[model samples]
Target: MSKSNFIKVIVAGFLITSIVGCGTKNFKKTPLDNYIVENSNEKQFSVILEDMDVDGTFFKTYSHKYRVIKHKEDDTPYEQISDWIEVDKKFFAKHEDNLGMVILEKKGQGKISKVASPPGYGYVGDSRYGEWRTHNGSTFWGFYGRYMFMNQMFGMINRPIYRNDYDTYRGGGYYGSRNYYGPKKGGSSRYGTNSQQTRKEKPNFFRRRASKSGWSSSRSRSGSRSRSTGFGK
Candidate 1:
């Protein structure tokens, strides 16, 4: 080969390698178990994954926003707190799809639970928090006077938790295992990273970084088992 042609080929290969390497990163996951164990003293509580952010630098790291929810008693209002936990690329990838979902919950001195679900669903069929109601013959969830705060807190004011949506979520048995967002009928689900309601809760995370990373596009990818789980699937 001519020297000039050989030099051009070598340059092309070098550029391709650089592009690929730029996207590759090695990150050690900060185990979610650690987070759960940190708060095990609470009798009833939930740890929610609210948002995810990737830092822009030569070496990228991640920051995860979490909301820890607790209700001291059946009649009392829930107490909620939020904080940011910095994590690595590997841990980020595992939970990036679960933004605005519950990652851990313990009820009434029960064991720490790692089943994932959209927030406020545990109250759907329970009579303590709410009861079923009808609007022009259409059924929906109606929170009691004291539990009214959940309507907005759970993103149900605009989204409106219809009976069918909750039934489908439960019928699919997605309550404790798979991360569910509305339903998976008609070849699509009504809620997820794209839902306006979800977007409202998760902030403008994907919208701000849509073009650069295609984070939304890659959300369909399955996640690996949680580090906190030891039970067989």
Candidate 2:
């Protein structure tokens, strides 16, 4: 082959090899790593776990799903951000050194009042304790936040908390109803009907009627007669 032709062949081979190598690297990633790389550019806020005073095992199981959310109206600070976090016990112990840092970050958007706590991120007086807000895109939810009771390992623990002027100032419209924050009395429900009861008591008569109508006409006739007779007619 001519010198120029040989050089061109070599260049073509290099290009093909580079493309194949890149594709191979991407295909070899774990499912989780592939997801992170694919969606890393999503718009969302960041949350840093400053200090954690929990045991190494606890820290390992601690899921990091926190966010820095701004109030809707006045742009003040609400309790929790929004995100999903899951950390098991062994996972926590295994990654103790990686604690006190941003662990799990989620994406999405929407103005939710509270960030939902994972299995073990709740506390007594926590207004934004149990439930979480919904949003589009993706957002982060740190594993540890203010509600946890670790010593001073991390140095800071700023979980969600309602301000004194929360009730007064209505700047941000991102506030959940009174029922949203928490129950009236401390840990228990103060009102006559709690959300759980309301949901349970709330029946779908429409669905029930449809189900009953599905019975054979003969069965339906018997049911009507039985109801009318009070016993067996």
Candidate 3:
């Protein structure tokens, strides 16, 4: 072959090799990239347990789902700037940590309010307690109760409070209206009527046992129901 032809061939081969290498590099995926693709529709926020002062405690590391109320673009990929509310107003946070650069902000827009303890049931001073079902169909009591206690102890009253009148469903066969103290009076409570319809139409994520991480399980109260004449009929 002529010298000129040999030089052209070498240059052509190098260009092809470079093009293939760039394509392969662009197609490579990282763990974070895979996670974001898998959970594209999900809006997850992570917080360092140590920063919350509950790192070494039983509530060290946990994951809870929250409905994104509002957010804005920043240096990080996505930051929950405005306050966000949990289902039933059970928990709330003013802001969330940067979920790294892989996550994208959810499409829906809304506002979240802080949860408040039911009236007359002070976290630091009162003895009365209650339980409520979260949006994920998991029953959360002590975890959030402890969170409230810790916040109050440190004078972080701006955190959130639980509302006694907030609508929630009870597990098992029985369903009814739950007040600050317990089930409300009168046979036909709003919750009971609503729950009966909900149970038939909606299926929930129920766990048979507590998680190994020390999170309480709803199964503990699986048999705590007492038959009532009002809602069942």
Candidate 3 local lDDT, 42-75, one digit each (tens): 4422211111100113222222222211212431
Q: Which stretches of candidate 1 lie over 4 Å from their true place?
A: 1-31, 73-75, 108-112, 184-188, 200-203, 211-233
Total backbone collisions, model 2: 32
Using lDDT as the yardstick, the better of models 2 and 3 is 2
Across residues 76-170, which tens digit of lDDT does each residue of candidate 2 receive?
Answer: 22334434343333333333333223333342342222222111122212244322322353222222355233212212123222322222223
| Candidate 1 lDDT | 0.65
**lDDT string, candidate 1, 1-233, tens digits:** 99999999999999999887876653333546675566567666666776777645344546677766676555454645555566655567667667777777776537555767767776677687789999998899889998898887766777777888888787897755677777655654556554555666555776666645644332344332222322111
Q: What TM-score does structure 2 among the candidates reach?
A: 0.22
Ten-residue segment with the worst summed lDDT in candidate 2?
224-233
lDDT scores in order: 0.65, 0.31, 0.27
The candidate with the higher TM-score, 2 or 3, is: 2
Compute the lDDT of residue 3 as modeled in candidate 2.
100
- What's the TM-score of every candidate structure? 0.68, 0.22, 0.19
Please give the TM-score that candidate 3 achieves against the real structure: 0.19
The alpha-carbon deviation from the true structure for residue 108 of candidate 1, after best TM-score superposition, in angstroms, is 4.1
